[model samples]
Target chain A: LAKTTQPISMDSYEGQEVNITCSHNNIATNDYITWYQQFPSQGPRFIIQGYKTKVTNEVASLFIPADRKSSTLSLPRVSLSDTAVYYCLVVENDMRFGAGTRLTVKP
Target chain B: GAGVSQSPSNKVTEKGKDVELRCDPISGHTALYWYRQSLGQGLEFLIYFQGNSAPDKSGLPSDRFSAERTGGSVSTLTIQRTQQEDSAVYLCASSLTPRGGPSYEQYFGPGTRLTVT
Candidate 1:
């Protein structure tokens, strides 16, 4: 199991690409980096997951280096609805979500 | 087409009373998880179930907290003798089981808000 660290908050303008990074120095083998989004008053939902390199989906993109020590979640053209808490999860034996980075998309 | 669903969107119970929260996972999903979130706090994993395997209860706060996934679709989380500290939002998620384990993209339901007085 690995502990993750992410920024507490981030501010971005609409139409901007927002990237939030998480560090997990102790990431173990077979671990996967997963990102989740949680809107206010709702449960958290998975947005994306990756093992290494880059993985992109309709909602977001994830980038991981060969070292596998950190990963970044990229949200392109973020809108007001994209404002929420973004959780970075490193799943090895079990899944654990960090405190997450609260992203605020401003007009 | 339907996402995960939970019942009793809001529950208010007195201290020492027991409460049961229900979760209905998406059809065909083989994995389900339960979590709790307090005011301004991050989610705390409680338990999870995968197919016919025994549930992972390592995250349960205490013996009073138990959960069961019946027929591998619907899950019920029971909190015995609820206390004021148990007030929080209970969230449920389900995912299509991946090759290694339940690490695939998960769909979530609107959480149930619990207020214990």
Candidate 2:
């Protein structure tokens, strides 16, 4: 598992596109970049994952650069319900979490 | 279609007492994991079980903390002589297989909140 660094918090108004960037300079070749969303009093939910380039799903998008040292999660048309903690992880078989970026979508 | 489930959503015990927490992984899932999260803190990996065997128990905080999985489906985490520091939310997750598999995305349980007095 590779360690990741991300912003402590971010704020956006409803209807805005929000992008949270994470840095994992020591990523391994087999490591995959994955993201999760967590709300208060609930377990984390898987959002998206990618090895390289870009991967998109109904919930969000993950963009991994060519170097694979960093990645970004793009959330489109944010709403008040989208407010939650976003976590970025680089892992192969192990699971670890950092102080995720808390996104606050204000009305 | 059910996800991982945990028993005793909350537990409160004295410092010298023992407590047990249970987790039921998703059906047919071969991998299970246990993690603890303190208030406003990142999750701390405690153990991992592949099938019925636990290959990684290094994350267990101390000797007093132990876990076992039977039938590769249900797991129990037991804590003896609980201390106040042991208070935290214990979570469980399971995937069809470990990472690198076609469907390794983990599904998590709501977690058991333990409060040791």
Interface root mean square deviation per prediction: 2.8, 1.8
Per-prediction DockQ comes to: 0.56, 0.65
Specify the poorest-scoring 10-residue window by lDDT in model 1 chain A: A90-99
Q: What share of the true interface contacts does candidate 1 keep?
A: 0.50
Candidate 1 stretches greater than 4 Å from native: B98-103
Chain B TM, every candidate: 0.95, 0.94
Give per-residue CA lDDT, model 1, range B1-117, as digits (tens).
Answer: 999999899999999999999999999999999999998788999998989988889999999999999988999999999999999999998888732333567788999999999
Give per-residue CA lDDT, model 1, range A1-107, as digits (tens).
Answer: 68999999999999999999999999888788888888999988779889999999899999999999999999999998899999998876576776899999999
Expressed as tens digits, the lDDT of each residue in B1-117 for candidate 2 is: 888999999999999899999999999998888999899887888998887554588789999999999877899999999999999999998888675533358789999999999
| TM-score, cand. 2 vs. native | 0.96
The top-ranked prediction according to TM-score is: 2
Error of 1 at B75 (Å): 1.1
